[model samples]
Target: KKTVTFFLVVLLAVSLFTQNDMVSAEIKPKERSVGKKCLEITCTMTYTTQQCSTHCIQMGYATGDCLPKEAAKPQPPEYCCCYFEK
Candidate 1:
């Protein structure tokens, strides 16, 4: 009985660690893809989508938009977020 319990404990620990690694591995690719495609630029509320796209094009990105700041307070200043192909 003691040996069975020990084996189960080890198996549980290994499974937990592997599950965490798999979760992180799944998340990392999304983070890397977004990091590669997006650039955040400070901008005012008056910044337009066309202007943002034009600026991004000039800077070599495929497109852009004036979007709200991530994880910011409600009604935060907009950012010119540019997207590009990898």
Candidate 2:
């Protein structure tokens, strides 16, 4: 009887998790843009955002989206990971 109860609880938890995942799922665009080569570059921590932007253009991208890297530990002078299309 105890084993059966544990099994039922586990089953319920799994089912709830699956339902929550499905509810939160959304379709994503297949491609943000086509026929463009996308390049992702991470600038050194010493470089500022403005520098990164300049570097992006020099790397052959018209523009860039620069953001910091996400990590499990605290980071300082956050690095910029820029993505652009050539």
lDDT of 1 by residue, 1-86 (tens): 99999999999999999999999998775433433233466665565778888998898877887766664563556677787655
If scored against the real structure, what TM-score would every candidate get? 0.44, 0.34
Worst 10 contiguous positions by lDDT, candidate 2: 29-38
Candidate 2 stretches with Cα past 4 Å from truth are 1-46, 71-74
Best by lDDT: 1
CA lDDT, every model vs. true structure: 0.73, 0.59
lDDT of each residue in 18-85, candidate 2, tens digit only: 98887777544345552223234455556556776676677766544445455465354355444553
* Candidate 1 TM-score over all chains jointly: 0.44
At residue 35, candidate 1 shows an lDDT of 32
